[model samples]
Target: MASDAVTIQVPGPHGDRDIRVSSPSRVLWPEQGITKLQLAEYMIAVGDAFVLANGHRPVSLQRFSADIDGEAFFSKNPPKGAPDFIRSVPVVYPSGRSHAQLVIDEPAAAVWAVQMNTITFHPWASRAEDTDNPDQFRIDLDPQPETDFRDAVRIAVELRAVMAEAGLTAFIKTSGGRGVHVFAPIEPVHEFLEVRHAVIAAARELERRMPTEVTTSWWKEERGAKVFVDYNQANRDRTMAGAYSARPLALAPVSTPLEWSELSDADPRDFTVLTVPGRLQSVGDPWEHFADDPGDLSTLLQWWERDLGNGLGELPFPPDFPKMPGEPPRVQPSRAKKP
Candidate 1:
């Protein structure tokens, strides 16, 4: 019996590769009726842009067993039976453990990921060649319960200013949800901890300037109806959805990049898998020159030292992480035993 499968030609740096996608008619996005084959086509449509932004990095594949709403898990390492084209790189986790993580180098690799039921691509801020020192400083502006995308936009606007002050050019993107991600191409001279501190310093500065609108509170209860500067995303092994990656939301939205001028008017819902390829064709990639000029962290690190002088110390790390030096208690403020 012949299974319902199809082979598609995906062009890459080497040449065109014939990739087979099984279950081509299987629906991945139930609401939009987007099938597995459509997802593969979407990857091919935006292949160049997607590879440009996410390639050469250690990427974690967000895979689903069924449709997006069903059981899902992250595949960091190269899964069994992965093609020779798909490579893996060694990375160190927060717990001092090291493991091999997958790296997507070209368009064919991305399409292959889609064939594996991968919905979202979470690439590390660092490149595969140098996993210890991050070449990108990333910040996630997460909207709280009462806040929304508009609030995230407002924070992103100010965050652009903040990055500019630190001598870094900011790139903006939708998180495919209500949040926004701001990234700056940085020199890979500093390790993840230093970059994390730099992010914290900038986050604190932004909070000071927009006290009512922004907060760096790691604990959700402490953050009101304000946008949270997710400083921890700058840490090692931490990642947000890479640009042009499709999120597993009902609408099948991609983490579309945006120009600063276009962000104010952009709506995330409009940048779905069904529409993003056309958007890419129309306006081109906003982050086309993202890595052209890399910025240093001198200014931001100075701010971190100054904040330290003012008694502003370390914040909580992700619960799964080992207890870091100088990190505050992991317990919630309300749950802590008072002296």
Candidate 2:
């Protein structure tokens, strides 16, 4: 008993615009029975915060053909026949190939993406105008098997203190999974490599502080049960789910932002598409002032240099990337040939 299509009026800075959602009753989240129309409505409800955190950046859309468990693919470039309001900016991928990537500037644009079957949005750390330099310093706290959300929370708190010592303020969010994401707004003066190094420096400091609880090890076998400080997330062309974006999980969980004071009690499961809008109404957006005061990476860069002087050189770059200048071998430690 659902309509074939529905048009939603989404209000933005330019004014209200109507976006049409096709197959409006198609269930995107089978567990919650969340229809495509409901997904579009969710975007409209969180539009402002969504744009503030993800707009004006190169974003890749994760689209699905059926439900959350169905066929999926990532749309990096603007798909053919995109609407006029949906624009794209050129960016270079790690493969050194330049291509135009989509940018969503308003709520209607996000709704339109929902119509295109997009279930998740991955926004790059750098803004569109300056794709080479990052304005955001991001760290993904990935919990290996045997670890859980509570473990990530502890590491995130300590990571916040580490960032504070480096003169940057940290923000926390659920990764829409068992992990956590910590971000800091930074001046877009340095390129992605330098910013990545700064993240490595911070992660190294955190590892030193909580040796048993945290690890910066790139290989999965080396991580054990510790929370991993994923520094690679800061590299060029790398991205994570943007704040307020709904994930493709069965429960329809969202990558919800949080206040530092409330992080300990925040439960990721309670932040699904069905619950987030009400929570936003009651508590307001935690990241409203995220970009109000942008800090530079000078202190972290100095630490990077200090670590370099101490003989801790470059770690391994992702396998697909052209081998970096000082990066260690991409081979797994256990797989490498004996000397």
Candidate 3:
């Protein structure tokens, strides 16, 4: 789209040269097609749309180090620090909407979207809603020290089953890391605090059932053999923003919407920026039929109340949200809990 078009200079150890770039979405192959700085520009441009569409004020991007060769950004003999580049510098947009943005650099992005009812095309897709409302919840699992890849896969399969038992439709994807993110869509009617409570409750229940293989412990040392179930991501301001591909042989690191079955033995790298369009060619936008992803906090809040509460028998999550000064307790002061 014209919105992403830009004329920029590519910087390298040798020298800097002018590069022309623009795209309907992202500048997919910056090293081969553009430069590192150019690709970063594309990331910034698309991200700007992501912000405005989700109800945020555009802000400047922080400068960070990245290597762009003609093949991929941080791929191919990546600089020692390339992997953490995008995240190393914080991305801050002016606050207004409790906006959340999608990560598009991997197939996992699509997989996460498809499993939840929140496909990327929704007005709320790829953006955060209000601090109270979140349209989706993700369970990020960590691998253990001696755990083999198969063990990680097994953990994902079991987690899916647990989510199903909770009446949640969750999809799984390779995190492009040595883990997986299980996504579930909920009605956006509750505040961030309530949804996270429900998430914690649900995660805790799952851990209780699978103490041998799963854990809800925030501290790694306490999590023994079990996979670390990170429900803290459900917190209002917390984000798992997507990362664009910096290399080819490097994992296809994007948010992918996935089928539950695929979670069993799927390759996280199968879905890359290059392959998605082709998959669209045959499968035709895998998430084409779903409603667009939601960014509204109000909707998320309502969903939390309705889906997480129990009526006849047992219950999950506290009925109300925790008082402000939420998570990472040291950061925000709780007026309601002052000593």
Candidate 4:
């Protein structure tokens, strides 16, 4: 009984009516006492502080709280209404430094918005002169493409290892798609460009060690048998729609949540809008305190410099969009299209 018009019992968070979003215009979040129209209104509000500030877009809210792998992340000692999904509220961040403090009456909508877009946080890589969010970077994965869930997991784990060895902490999330995203928490000191290079260094090194398991190409065709570790995605000019909440997922499915350990062993089939809360409660959350985020880019760069050229010749590149000097056109869309 749900449609563009406000309806009920369509199946959501607490109950069918507990969570639901309308098509043309509406969002009913009974768990948080937020209505379809009201939520949409907030979307318009945050646009100023968030979107315009960072050149990012606002993702729509839904009736449900993202089923995050919390057993491992949120400590039980959090305040009474820390985030019990049913008892807590949802927050949205189109873009801007939120106090990160979650007040029950006015929880941070921006953070809640992550479930909707694939967000990247360059946490520590800051320069002494800058004053904006040091954790500024974009996310650019195939928002809607056929992919191997296993490879996505591999990408996250490998990134975690790379970051860990580099002396930085990176958290991973299921992009609510055929991919997973690894986020590094950095302090707000450096601008977008420096952070972007740090990410690039880390990514290139991973491609070197895991040659068959990963690809660092910006082009798709060149990424035939490996997970494309897209370094270009870290470009300051790019942005990732935050993951977890809801997005224009080529259709209408929302980006779901997962626990930390799950990355070692979990499938995309285990999650969906209707059947996630129960799992969330039973297992609690998996990534309660994923990794100790030290927020150091200098250390990461050191690791990168030492290991960059140690991989293969050079990773595969895309087609004639532009021919770099010595590199051959690595991708052949026409050849791949040939039967």
lDDT of 4 by residue, 123-231 (tens): 1212213423345332223322445767677666667777777666666556556777676656655555456557767777676778767766666656666676665
Clashes of 4: 47
lDDT of 3 by residue, 1-339 (tens): 234644454343235434333332332344334333333443333332222222221111211222221221111111233222111112232233332233322222222222121212222212322324556656677677765545667877776676666666665545555667666656667655566666666666667677788776655556677677776666544444332222222432444445555566666667654454444346433233222542233333343455446431112212233434423432223333766
- The candidate with the higher TM-score, 1 or 4, is 1
Residue 288 lDDT in candidate 4: 45
Q: What is the TM-score of each candidate against the true structure?
A: 0.98, 0.98, 0.53, 0.53
What TM-score does model 1 achieve against the real structure?
A: 0.98
Expressed as tens digits, the lDDT of each residue in 53-109 for candidate 1 is 999999999999888998999999998999988899999998899999999999999
User: Over all chains combined, what TM-score does candidate 4 have?
Assistant: 0.53
Q: In candidate 2, what are the lDDT values of residues 210-261, reduced to their tens digit?
A: 9999999999999999998888898888889999999999899999999999
Per-model C-alpha RMSD: 1.2, 1.1, 12.3, 12.2
Residue 21 in candidate 2, Cα distance off native in Å: 0.6
Off by over 4 Å in 4: 1-132, 136-147, 247-253, 279-294, 303-339
